[model samples]
Target: MSPRKVSLMSRILVYVLVAIAALYLLLCVALFVFQRALIYFPQPSAYATPDNVLTLPVADANLQVSVRPHDGPKALLYFGGNAEDVSQNLPSFSAAFPDQAIYLLHYRGFGGSSGSPSEEAIARDALDLFDRVYAEHPQVAVVGRSLGTGVAIRLASQRPAARLILVTPYNSLLELGIRQYPMFPVKWLLKDTFDSAKYAAHISVPTLLIAAEHDEVIPRSSTVRLYGQFIQGVASMKVIAGVGHNSISESPEYLKLIGAGL
Candidate 1:
């Protein structure tokens, strides 16, 4: 090839590389700007009942906690998915575990809760809720699903939850983020990395991890890894067949296993 032709090709390659780099940079910037939107999917309360709603004041925010009050020391605290309306689960939970009082938390900015959602804020609020529940009810079990699994695991590790149940749980949001955005430095960029693996080692309570056999959102390996992080014999796993991540609750076995955990 002629020297002029070689020079032209080199210039073209430089321009293409610069364009690619610019696009990647733009993508990283957008990911940084709208990262929270990608993480927390806050929704309005689906089953709003003034009588059942308990207002718990967190710092600079009033969190809506749905309570099915029962006159007993047995209580169950539930933390739900990112976009879940936990109030909707009251009837089912009440029926499943009638003996225990139920309290379902609506994460910050979710349902009627004030302020925005973050890992730090949710963890703090959950710990506070657990403490309050523990005060009234000495025997308390905790349940979490999806995003709430991270919150529940953290609380279980920090507090004395009699039992812990995680439904369709992931190892960590950081792992999920890294998998979803392989080209980006997700661990560094992610502000709310819900790393449940960090807390799993500290959880010594009887723990049950329920996995969806057909889970499309969180990889089965992630759930297995999380289960392994727990001290052997402290955590047990159940994989319900013919269910995906969202539809796992629909399975009859789901409630049965949850009840068994308690």
Candidate 2:
């Protein structure tokens, strides 16, 4: 290459490298300043499960849990949305799994629970709750929706579940991180990257995955990619035709999917 061209190319490369290094440093400073926001996954009171509901005491916090059994002798443990009030789903869960007992896990710092919530802590709480609930139930199935899918997959991977069901799931938090922070260097900055797709395929259980065609938060493509990761023969996938992320449960197709899968 000519000397002039080489000098220009080297200068551009230097500037690019300097920009990347500066961005990395800024990300570290931002994360450190907002560490509490990242670590403490708090939900608003509007999404609280129920003040009158029962609580299962965890190590440093408590979990709001509701148990309902139907005519059948089976059981289902349902995890809800990130900012959702799990108590709102209790009625539907009770109706759908009328023959089986159901337990709902409220995330830490959500509902009436205490303590902070992060990826590790939420997964830990889920596994612990599964142990307690599994002891009292048979044919236990674990279900997760949206953000809780991470906790569910972690628990299902470690525990013995008759089935693992995920609704409107994602490939990983890193994927979502890229979407929300396109310009930021998220892979290094993220403290919790819930990669359900990584664990879903390895989970040794009958699995059912449901995605909404019109999901707003998690793109249909992301859910589809995650669903694709499931091992063959042991897993199944379905989608609610017109439903979005929040209203997947409201769709008749979704109810049918859950009913048939269970």
Which is the leading candidate under lDDT?
A: 1
Worst 10 residues of 2 by lDDT: 43-52
Model 1 bad stretches (over 4 Å): 1-5
Report each candidate's C-alpha RMSD, comma-separated, in the order given.
1.3, 4.8
User: Scored by Cα lDDT, where does model 2 land?
Assistant: 0.77
lDDT of 2 by residue, 1-75 (tens): 999999999999999999999988888789746754753455543323344255788777887765564445477
Give candidate 2 regions above 4 Å deviation. 1-28, 31-52, 69-73
Best by TM-score: 1
TM-score of the candidate numbered 2?
A: 0.82
Enumerate residue pairs that collide in model 2.
Answer: 70-98, 70-99, 71-98, 71-99, 72-99
